[model samples]
Target: MSFLPASADAEFDLLCIGNAIVDVLAPVDAGVPEAEGLVPGSMTLIDAQRADALYGRLEPEQQTGGGSAANTAVAASLLGARTAYLGTVAADALGLAYADDLRRAGIFYPTAPLDAERAGGHSTARCMILVTPDGQRTMSTYLGACTAFGPADLDERAVARSRMLYLEGYLFDPPAAQDAFRRAAEIAHDAGRKVALSLSDPFCVGRHRAAFRALAAGHVDILFANEDEILSLYEAADFGQAAAAAARDVELAVLTRGEKGSVVFCRGERTDIAAQPTTLRDSTGAGDAYAAGFLFGLARGLAIAECGRIGAVAASEVISHFGARPEGDLRALAGV
Candidate 1:
């Protein structure tokens, strides 16, 4: 069997690096959390024992492949951009499923699975997503083998082959992963390719604020973040302050606000792009989808404003679905 399908023969337009996780989603009433004594809107990492305990308490409605950066890579590929993903998983059922899902979505999958001891004894990285009637999703994650991912996991050749390298802020949680991120950044820079990063979540920003600032100032050429994440990163009192601070640090800063739309800042020029109108469904992958569309636009040489528009449309489509992965051809949805 081919490692990469025939469709991946050419040099990729983008390469993504981060944890590889599978998402378990279930629909429940908004009040279920209060009744079950579970926290809503916060992702907590649990050990294998805890994961089993939680798994036993509920019914799993669906299983799908996910990870912040991996989701963006898959979405970008579906938008007709050549993409590759780098991450680690155990040599277990979930690992195979994750790889297959990326491959089927037209993304180049290059990471190998861990040994049996890692897969069975320790849980695979799994996110238990609880969706409410109001289209809100609360997530509980078990990092498991994902935390074991480190610098050695990176594929330097693949990094050099891509036009851009994209990373997620969540990777900073594991100290070992920092080396891999730095290595990928160096490789991408040495090869004259752009490097992009998504501030995965507000908690992630709070966890690695200093390091993130250093990265934003030096390594990251393109930066993506939502209002809350940006505020946390800069320790700013409001969104505007954070956006201005980010613009001064990076070559391009794309800041997204849920209902207000998104802002693109580049070369001292700031432009606001209106959000595409859509009935809200689940906001699970809105940020990732927005990053996908924006990256896709950049890869296709579209203007910054047009890129933000594409990002908004992509986000709108994902919010109208239950899963983090896009349900249809996003290129068609973006009218590209």
Candidate 2:
């Protein structure tokens, strides 16, 4: 299906789909990961009991809202794009907090909360992030009530009204959620809206490589991945091979190589954009912010190179702060 720009009267520029999770950020020494028997730089899905045990070990420095696609939706809104989010949450305190955070950030989140009584006695989803002084963040997420998300939760009119549908790869963990993604993609495609997908993590890519490949080839117009994730997706020996493989499936493929820079491949052309120079206070939401900026540029009909530059600038801003949320006006940063 061909990608189409949103009409002037469209309700939103972008719509994001993913889990809804609150982030509990804690600054810890480098040894904390080992102490907790965790692998550094990896995102591990934990049970509610494990989440509590991990939370008890680290002193929380701050609490913020974060979910891969939700974070991107917030960033896109901050960058001056009309944005919406679709995800599930229970009628609990954390769920309320998550909705409040999204609303306050100017994101349209219309998903009705699940009834508290029928929520399987679970709270909302949460991610416990341990940040090191060097700006590396390791995450342990408890999916919690978000696991209840499925195709039934999607609003078809809302999906059709947006110019683009942004999906998070993390949602592939559950079979029902995978169906939800496929349904959303079909709706977006039928409406002539573009669809983008992020290969959230290397492990996530490894888990659903075949499905991801087919989806990217048939439905996705823009594909996002990091060095390790793209390599894992193609089972390639190196980034070059992975990038080459990616170019054949999607019209646009954006590969982020932390610190080194990012590569944007469109059609048969490639553009290498440098990472903005900034102090790395935390790397928690860099990719999400980058996607937000890129989507904002695309919504505005900016050239591909400008889109990549805006993405780099947004990523730089997120890494310079302590959380995944934007601290300043990204529109001004991009000189839009």
- Clash counts for the predictions, in order: 0, 0
Which is the leading candidate under TM-score? Answer: 2
The per-prediction CA RMSD against the true structure, in angstroms, equals: 4.6, 1.7
Evaluate model 1: give its TM-score: 0.93
lDDT digits (tens) for residues 183-281 of candidate 2: 999998888788999999998998899999998998888999999999999999989999999998998999999989899888758989899999999
**TM-score of each candidate?**
0.93, 0.97
- Candidate 1, clashing residue pairs? none
| Candidate 1 global CA lDDT score | 0.84
The count of residue-pair clashes in candidate 1 stands at 0
Candidate 1 lDDT, 1-336, residue by residue in tens: 211113333388889988788988888887876665566765666667767777777687778888889889988988998899988888878888888988888888888888866444565688888889898877778887787778788888889888889998877787778877888899888877888999888888888999999988989988999998999999999888999999999888999999999998985689999999999988888999999999888887788888889899889999897888888778788899
CA lDDT, candidate 1, residue 154: 85
Reference-based lDDT, each prediction: 0.84, 0.89
Candidate 2 residue 156 Cα shift, in angstroms, is 0.9
The pairs that clash in candidate 2 are none
